[model samples]
Target: MSGTFQDRIPVLLVEIMRKFPEERSESEVLLVHNMLSSVSMFRRYSGTLQLLLARVVRYQRLERRRVVIKKGHWGHSFYFVFSGLLAVTKDNDGSSAFVDKEPILIKKGMSFGDVALIKTLRRNATVVCMEETELMVVDKEDFFANKMDVELKREFDYRFSFFRSLQLVSSWSYSLIEQMADHSKAEQFRYGHVVVKDTNDMGNIIFIGKGQCDVLRVVDLTSCSAYQRLLKQYADSVSRGTCLPTHGFKSELTNQPGSVIKHKVLLNNPPRPPRGLLADLPTSACFLIDTLHQSSTFGLNQYLMPSKQRDCRRFTLVSQSMEIMRVEKTRFDKLVDNTTMKKLEALQKTYPSDDELCTVFLEHSRWKDYKHSVVQDLFPHRVAPIRSPKTQKQQGHCGPSQVLQQTRHVVNRLKQTKQRVEPKDNKIKK
Candidate 1:
């Protein structure tokens, strides 16, 4: 088995060398390999298949405003972006008028032209370089020869199917949906990953292609009426010497007579609620505003409303092992008509305000604390005893210092007992 494995190594090396074109250096081959792995469409293929693709791809650099492919033309080759941006448009002549339409952009790590080649049909859209672009081109003959058409076809079908099922775009024309499918890329995120942060200004219109996610808003509990009531109750309990242990409080109060006034001032001016992303806050502060399932959409409100009218509350979308399709807000605005835009604006749901969510959270938290306290009072024996400072010190199994302290304590107690017994024996003898 070892000898057979050793014999296969040279054959594999020779095959790799033959796959790469003679013009490509070892460094260039490695660069192409990295590019293929980074691109979503090509990343799913096996290492051998990727290597075969890297072999046939040729480098092409085009200046800004150059037309890579025009609509109604025969599909000649497949193109993958290595750097810079390209715009996909519906214009047949590739005129300047298309620029006003804000066409969908294809950027680095993105690929296009597969739809036309895989279907063996004329190009349905025009792709023009928006910036000086570096592209890796695979001619139609080499693309088909390597059977890459099959994989490209599968990806195109998957995207199309997903877009077709979406109700938001159900009224859209078939061609428009196909164009969207060509531009949008699908991405997967693990559970608890923040797909969109609260502070993001230029957010993408996201469609939950698969799995679930939560829309959460961070609320300031300190501002709510319920929180104020709870705070007042806590203060009252402290004043009555009920909730807190009295041993430390008595000494502190004796040492600092004005501490009560300072405490009240501190309560009145609680530190300003933390500002920034919801992901940075504690989970308790983040309230679930909505749960998004497959086919649900978010980040549309920004496009539907003017800047001033848009909701100012900060929120984030966290994934639960989800697959999402993201379209740039600018691209989506250009894709749909005014009527569809109006319909989407009407469908936007209003979420609970921070003040309201804060009130609810405070009430729920209070009830939970009440129930726990009642349980401890009813079943006192079942509640675990809290260790005292002295007991905690002895429990530290860290080093010899703790053991020496414990020994000294025991010895001091024994000396005190012996001294008391000696005094009592003297009185009895007298």
Candidate 2:
């Protein structure tokens, strides 16, 4: 089946190219193919069916804030994001989708309008282009012609079931849970991959549907009490002349004819001690603060906390072969009522302040530089010497040509002395 599918891809791609009005590179077509593969609606289909779907999918470009589908309108097409962002809103009116309520952002590799197309019902929600978006569109006629809608209902059902099992959304109404499932996209991450970065501004809430993840914090170890003791030990080593070696002046002498020349290279500046001397002391490190398992949700604190307080601490979520259901924070905030928001806020976890850690790192760096300066001042001998070009020239430095000339003159004198000694020895033998 796989080999047959592989063999058909080239022929299918040629058909896809004909569907597009403008020329598309092989890479661009392949990108569209990958995007189609990522869509949840297409995942259940066989490779051959997916390739067939690819042939019928047409390219579309929509400007920012354009409404692709409105609530209560007959669904005519299904969309897969080729590039750019889109928003799905519950609002019937197009204007309110972006103004009154925050809409769920649909990013690249995601699809929309499948629910309405599959059920053959009017679009219950509105979808608008958030930016200049490039989409691969499948018309209702083509969508159903291939029987692509068959497993779409089942996919949604599975998502709805998954949401129902979560205690976090247990208080939510059935309609709300269903809506959440519709907007949420399942994403996978490899083990040890960063699912969410420290203090991410995007503020997308992630629910761990399967596997595990770790919550990590970057810590500045200079603030620790143990570091203070180590700093004292370093200071003692510096004072006792054991921390670094002393710098020495280099001198070279050259004798030619009646004159003796001396090249005195002075040690002007000393080399700074290696930072690795404090290798035992870590300036910064990452600490595993907590681990999240199945059904655990994160990225809520940013929504609950005030802007000033939101990013005070740095928290990163790293995945361990995890599958996650992610929803935009703005959409989440719009979905829940004031009471639910309060409940979520109450469950917000606090972490150590990143500001304090930054301050500790800065203070330690300054102290390190200050300690180096003090060592140079008190124990001047330990500092390495620097040779200045201007000083060398002023001290009658020997040029390469002059040195070669002097060497030749010395060789000739030795040869003349040898010749005179040889003739005297010959006379003695006679």
On lDDT, the candidate that comes out on top is 1
Which candidate comes out best when scored by TM-score?
Answer: 2
362 Cα displacement, candidate 2 (Å): 16
TM-score, per-candidate, Cα-based? 0.54, 0.55
**How many Å off is the CA of 155 in candidate 1?**
2.7
Candidate 2 per-residue C-alpha lDDT over 1-430 given as tens digits, one digit per residue, 9 for 90 to 100:
1113332224444455456433555565565567577555454344555665665688676888888999999878888775677877877656665675556678766678876776678988888887777677878887667666664555567678998997667788999998888776566777756676654554578888889876655444455554455566667887886662211101112222111122111111222223645432334434344567888777764466667865566556667678888776777777788667666865565543444333333343344456657887999888467779896664464432233333333323323343432233221100
Residue-level lDDT tens digits of model 1 in 67-146: 99999998888887766778877886555534566667787767878667766789888888776776777788877787
Which portions of model 1 miss their true places by more than 4 Å? 1-141, 188-194, 198-203, 219-284, 301-303, 338-346, 383-430
User: Per-prediction count of colliding residue pairs?
Assistant: 0, 4
